[model samples]
Target: MIHKREFLRRNLPYDGRIKLASYYNSRHVRVPVKAAQITKAVRWHASLLQPVTGIDPAQLSARSLRAGGAMALLAGQCDTNTIKLLCRWHSDAMMRYLHQQSLPIFQRLSSKMFNNGSYTFLPEDWVPAAAE
Candidate 1:
């Protein structure tokens, strides 16, 4: 994807303003994608994928691609700083983009927390069963 963007940047004539996400218009001129065009494309593709993916076309938008990329990087164990740089996030605001932190991460954290604190949430009136 980066290589494709770079190839478009170097090859396309855009008066020194290269757009990473662009398409050739019907007139054969490459132009930057507008917001509406991106939304339309996302919806169109989602509709096509709905049968196999079972994803609602209405649930996807241009922003879904950004969040999905960030989630993919997080799931791959990429460092937060690298994700921030790649996502062009200026601050810790990038954390908000990671809304769906997976259950495994939470489970790992919970185990670590309980072990470090020497604590458990068992009921006070409960007792261990006899070995049988």
Candidate 2:
């Protein structure tokens, strides 16, 4: 969801070819990066290395952040459907990870549901308040 202005700002000018030809003739143009590099670049930009915070970039890794995100999602009551969509996981690996992480919450929810007399709740009585 990058804005067009941001894209233009970050990218080489559309007229770069004319400028490059005048400046550096006979030089090979760099090949376009693969999708993996693009993903990595975006991830790195969004990582824990903030200039204001002065956090050491060496202390952060994509894998650690990914694991932390998964754990946070589990704690935040995000469902498997949401996780699958967010993480782009097509296999059962995410399910296994979520199951492992969410075992305690699942157990508690199951116990609560079972202990209740019925799973269904009674409809709330609705009354329209007088207009102010």
lDDT by residue (15-114, candidate 1, tens digit) is 4455667766555566777777887999999899999999998888888788789888888888889988998888987677685555666677788877
| Model 2 residue-pair collision total | 0
- Writing each residue's lDDT as its tens digit, candidate 2 over 26-65 gives 3433344444554576457646456766655444454545
Cα deviation of 108, candidate 2, in Å: 1.4
Model 1 per-residue lDDT at 130: 100
lDDT, residue 38, candidate 2: 45
Best by TM-score: 1
Query: What's the lDDT for all of these models?
Result: 0.76, 0.59
Clash pairs, candidate 2, are none
How does candidate 2 fare on TM-score? 0.42
Give me the candidate number with maximum lDDT: 1
